[model samples]
Target chain A: MAVIHTDDSGDPRLDDFRHLSTADRRPDRPGGKGLVIAEGTVVVSRLLASRYPVRALLGVERRFAELAGELAGTDVPQYVTSAETMADVVGFHLNRGILAVADRPAPLTVDDVVTGAGTIAVLEGVGDHENLGALFRNAAALGVGGVLLGPGCSDPLYRRSVRVSMGHVLRVPFGDLTDWPGGLDDLRARGFAVAAFTPRPGSVPLRELREHAPGPVALLFGAEGPGLTESALAAADHAVRIPMPAGVDSLNIATAAAVAFYELASGG
Target chain B: MAVIHTDDSGDPRLDDFRHLSTADRRPDRPGGKGLVIAEGTVVVSRLLASRYPVRALLGVERRFAELAGELAGTDVPQYVTSAETMADVVGFHLNRGILAVADRPAPLTVDDVVTGAGTIAVLEGVGDHENLGALFRNAAALGVGGVLLGPGCSDPLYRRSVRVSMGHVLRVPFGDLTDWPGGLDDLRARGFAVAAFTPRPGSVPLRELREHAPGPVALLFGAEGPGLTESALAAADHAVRIPMPAGVDSLNIATAAAVAFYELASGG
Candidate 1:
């Protein structure tokens, strides 16, 4: 590992770590670098283990010590600085104390993610970064094989998302379904049953999902309030709902997805 | 309805809504009024329906108009002001457009939450306000009868929590378990099976929980990282786990609890 000790917050070498609150937004707009950022030791460790090319790391001394074993074989530059200097460079007080940035790797294909998967998550209109990240975290813990981002979905590698996913966004294979409702047919042609989650009347209970599909399945989710559109719902092989008590509109997208993920994984 | 028109941000009637970020903190510290604050129309509406006594409201005219039906029979002062003045009084811009403050009603006992409940949630060390609120929202959506707070949990009535819960914190009954692990026994004596959620080896899988406790069940959850204490685990009738793959630690506490709540509610 190449370790460089520096006290100056203005060192151009620390540019990747600067003004992070807005820097992460650069990835989604025109002429943006689209770099994947990971925060804290746990997430940084995951980034180090991912396929993305590590650009560099910026952190304090103690965090480096904790990650020494993981850093030994890596050749990336590790910038060490004081907490105050780090705060100045980052434009916020990041108590996480460590950060890593990586260049985006080649995007995975939907076919690649689904090739050996039993259960996968496909999302539509899930623009919120934290919810997208939480869904990835839940998907990882519950053993969902892959994630296919349908239209209107946010970039899973966005900084807030990577932080919230606890860096699982780096590990989970996700590919865009750019065709919207039309693309769901691709999964069907691949012999995967598509189940869109909605609370609309006549939707089946989440518990009976296994019976409806009884094979490799794709669980489709929409954003929290607006939910799935009519065309999207019509395209799926099954419409599933986590039966809720009257008056409660719906669960947060990630929480509801976790319940469905757990149900499918447990075969309960 | 007592609709009081006031353009003055310094109006004493708006004191309950002033400097709200710090004011909410007052409830947890010494001599705090322990007031419950609700934001936006959905939450404010729920607060209006709750047993707690409403103190007053501060909002823009549009929000008041939207809530006119709910406010028709109420007599509390509604301080109408411009968005700028409302922002000045509250010390921040609250796009939620409306706010309501209520005095906490008489505290509920564990018995109150457990009574007439088919399934209940018991929490330990869940100190994060958002997590506490999310758990209550999940509990309410999934039809968990009530919530019992054990050691290390934060107050559900905290402003951030109430908002995160979408104000389900007002509707779902909750009480403190002041006796720590010992209070778990009281749940057992009442014929409610106390199943603690832990990922420890040899623990029963969450899907198997219903088989272990077919009747009334209380799903116990600990904080995300450390999990339940051994003493607390031992006190429960069953130690349950949401089965996960190797290397992943666990799900977020609220999401995990939601999975358990769905399992018990669905009887899958």
Candidate 2:
């Protein structure tokens, strides 16, 4: 490990660690070097273990000491600074106390992600970073084999999504499903039942959907309020709903997906 | 209906709606009404339908017209203000374009909440308003009869909780269990199996826990990080865990509760 103690918040060597709130948005930089940043010790450790190439780490001395085992053979520069200076450099008070930045790795193809998977989440219009991240976390926890991002979804590697997902975003395999409703046909061709989750009347309850599609399943979810679009719903082999009390709005998108994922993965 | 038009944002009649982000915290002031304020048409409608006595509403003319059916017989004041004026008074952009404030209703006793509850959620240290709200939403959706707050829990009626819950906080019954872990004994005495959810090893998986505690179960959850205190876990009749992928952290507290609540309430 190349350990470097730096006290100057504006040191040019730490340019990548500056103004993180805006750094992740630049599309014109090297390798889009607006790198994927993992905050907090837990997420930073996950980043170090992930396929993404770790560029460097900037955090407090205590945090660096905590990461000693993870950085045992790493030759990456580890900049140690005070919490206040780190906060000043990051343009926000990062209570997590540690941050690791990684270069974007090569994108995985859909086939690469689904080669040996039994269950996968296919999302549409799930633009919220936190929701997307939470979905990945649930997918990982419930044993969903992979994730396929349909149209209108945000990049899962976004920093907020990574942090909110507790870095499960790094563990779960996900790839773009560029064909929208048409791509769902590919899932069906691969012996997977495409069950779209919605609250529409006459839809089968999630319990029944699980009973019917008892094998490999691709659970399709849409944004919370608008729900799965008509084309997406019609494309699926079946429509599933979580039974809700009368007069209540549908559950949050991520929560609903978690329940569905749990049922499908757990055989309930 | 007391329909009044005010073009000026500074009108004294609008004092109740001023700087709404912080107004909800002032519970000690006269007409110091830490009134339950609902934003957006959906939540406002729920506020109108709840037991809380409606004080008044302020919104754009278009929004008022949309709520015409619900407001038809209301004798409460209705202040019509332009979007610009409403934003000025609220001290932020009011995209929902409507607001309603209601007087707090009589507090429900613990007995009032537990009287008919077969399946309930008992929260400890779940002080985050958004998590509390999401928990209520999940509870209402999954048919958890009520929520019982143990020590270190925040007020469910707080404004952020109300909003994040999509106003389900108004619908779901919740009251304090002031005695902490000891109150869990009361639940066991009432013939409700108190099942504490923890990620600790050797605990029964959630699915098995549901089957084992087949009736009148009280699902106990703790804050996200620390989980259930040893006292709370020791008091539980059964310590249950949601089976997660190896090496993954536990799910968010509210999401985990939703999954547990669904398992118990849905008879899976």
Candidate 3:
């Protein structure tokens, strides 16, 4: 691996790390290449282990040394710069001194995701990037095999989402459900029970529903306020609720999803 | 009930709601007079049901009508304002277009919180306001009777925490653990098994730990990144983990807490 030491913030070689806040906005330019950027030592290490192709790394020398084992066999360029210069190029002061950028791998297909999975999360109208990322983290922790993004879900690869998810977004497999509620039929055909989570009256409590959908299950969640639409709820094999206290609004979308994931993982 | 129509944002009567971004900072105001402000209709309804002494409400008429049932018997002044004037007083444009201010009620005692609780969440070093709030929300949803705040925990009544918790912070009972690890002893004396959550090896998986701490468990958690301190973990009866996939970092603090709370409430 080549380690280049540079003190100049304006050096053209450092352009790929320039104005990173806006770099994600444009994907056409080499510097603005829309790469999957991982910040901090933990996330950077995950990026190295992920399937995405690492382009380069920019960090203080200390962080680079911390990653010595991960970088041993890789030939990617590692740029060493002062914290001041690194902050100037990144357009903000990042407390996490190390960052790694990787090229986006080919998108996974629904079949690729569900081929060997027993449990999955299907999200609808979960537009908040933090929530989307958090759901992935929860899914990964609770043993959910994959995630299917339905309508109105944001890109999990977004920088903020990646950060909020603590880089679990890179590890969890996800694919778009382009067919709306119709795609749910595909999941049903795959020997999975679709359970839509809502707080509406007559919905089965999550604990009881788990007994019925004991096999492979797809836990469907929607955004906090406007829960799963009528069609989405109707498409599921059953509707389940977490049984919140009376007079309380629903829990945050990510929190609700976490409880559901835990319920399914614990065999409710 | 005084239903006053006010067009002027600068009216002296509306000062309680003025520049609300910084209003909570004043220490001498009601509840130290800074006013426990609730934004959005859902939170406003929660404020109405809470023991806090209501002062008045300011909102667009549509939101006022949405809160009609909650405001029925209240004699506090209701200042109806246009969305623009409402924004002017609150120091920013609030899409919810509704706000309610109330005096803080007396703090609850630790005894009050623990008296009849079957399951509770005890937190330490959880200073992040949003995390604290999220914990309370999870505690409420999962039927954790109360929360005990150990050292380094932030105030659950803080504005941002309340908002992030969707006002559940106001509903859940919480008290500070003034005696540090000693307070945990008090819980143990009350026949509650205190289980400290950690990611370290040798800690029992949460599912198995729940069986050991079967009756009236108190699940202790710490802030993200830096988990439960050595002293806090040592004070507990046993250390527990969520059985995450190997190589994955721990789940978010609130998410982990939610899973534990769910396990305890759902009879393990």
Candidate 4:
């Protein structure tokens, strides 16, 4: 690990860490489509383990030393400074103590993610970054082999999404299904029964769908307010619903996705 | 409804809604522990439908007109103001356009909530207001009959929790089990099989628990980091586990609870 000791906050080397909140404003910079940031030691460790190339790390000495074992084999420069200097450079009191910036790698093709995947979550119009992140976290925890993002989905690499997902967005394999409902057709061709989740009439309960389709399954989701579009629903082989109590709106999309993933993963 | 036109934000009658963020700072106010507040038409509608006495309403003329039906028979004061005035009174921009203040009714006892309930969620140390709110939302959507708060739980009536829960926290039946782990014995006496959720070995998977617990079950949860305490676990009739992928930490407490609620609700 290349440890660089510096007391200056305005040093040219610290340019990437300045006004961290606005770092993503210029995505056309050298570090791909914005630098993929991982906060704290845990997420930074995951970032280091991921395929994303770690460009640099900024942290207090203790934080860098805490990651010394993980940093030992890595070649990226680690910026060491006092907590005050670190705060001055980052424009906030980052209690996380450490941060890492990485360049976003070339995205995986939908085919790359779908290959040999048994259970996948196909999302449509999930533009809310937090919900997108939570869905990825749930997908990873519940054994969903991959995620296929459809139209109107936010970037999983967005800083807020990465933070909310606890870096699972970095771990889980995902790729944009650019073809909309047509991409869902491709998933079906790959031996997956595309099940669209909605509470509308004529839909089978999710529990029943678990038994009906025992092989590969692609569970489809949409944004919270307006669920799966007509085209997206029509493209699916089945419409499944989670049984919710009366007089309540549908669950948050991520929570709904978690329930579906649990049911499918449990093979119930 | 008793409608009043108020262009002045400094009106003494509007004190309850003044400096709303700091309104709860002094809990020992005229109303017990500050007034329960509901923001937005959707949440205000739930407040109207709730048993809590609606003391007064403040909103734009358009919002008041939208709720004309719900307020038809009620005699509560509806202070109509412009959006800007409403914001001035509330000390923040009111995007929800409407707000309702309710007197906190006497809390229901644990026995009151557990009576005739088939399933309940027992939470310990879930201090995060948003997580508590989301758990309540999940509890409402999934058929968890009620929530039992143990130690370190935050007030569900906190403004943030209410907003984040989509106001389902208002709809859900919840009560504090002040006896801590000893409350488990009381629940067992009420014929509930206490099943604490944790990832420790020797715990039955949540799906298998559904089959094993054919009778009323109390699903136990704790905060995400430090899960249920030993005393809580020891008191449970069984320890239940959600099947999670290896290498990942547990799912967010709310998401995990949602999966458990769904599993128990589906009776799989």
- Error (Å) of candidate 2 at residue A117 is 1.3
Model 4 regions lying over 4 Å from their true place = A30-32, B30-32
Better of 2 and 3 by DockQ: 2
Model 3 agreement with the true structure over B51-70: per-residue lDDT tens digits = 78888899999999998898
What is candidate 2's lDDT per residue for A17-59, written digit by digit as tens?
A: 8898887687687655367899988999988998989888999
Off by over 4 Å in 2: A30-33, B30-33
Which lDDT tens digits does candidate 3 get at residues A1-268? 7899988999887777888887667658454437788999989998999888988899999999999999998889999999999999999998899888888888899998887898999999999988998888888888889999999998888888888888888999999999999999999999999999999989898879767888999999999889999999989999998886776667888878887887777665
> What TM-score does chain A of each model score against the native chain A?
0.96, 0.96, 0.96, 0.96
True contacts kept of 1: 0.97
Better of 1 and 4 by DockQ: 1
The residue pairs in collision within model 1 are none
Q: Candidates' TM-scores?
A: 0.97, 0.97, 0.94, 0.98
What TM-score number comes out for model 1?
A: 0.97
**Model-by-model lDDT, in order?**
0.91, 0.88, 0.87, 0.89
In model 3, the clashing pairs are B29-B32, B29-B33, B29-B34, B30-B33
Name the regions of candidate 1 deviating beyond 4 angstroms.
A27-31, B27-33
In candidate 2, how many Å is residue A188 off?
A: 1.3
Answer with 1 or 2, whichever has the higher lDDT.
1
User: What is the CA-based DockQ of model 3?
Assistant: 0.72
Worst 10 residues of 2 chain B by lDDT: B24-33
* Top candidate (DockQ): 1
Query: What are the per-residue Cα lDDT tens digits for candidate 2 across B11-44?
Result: 9888878888887578566444477889889999
Compared with the real two-chain complex, what DockQ does model 4 have? 0.92
Better of 1 and 4 by TM-score: 4
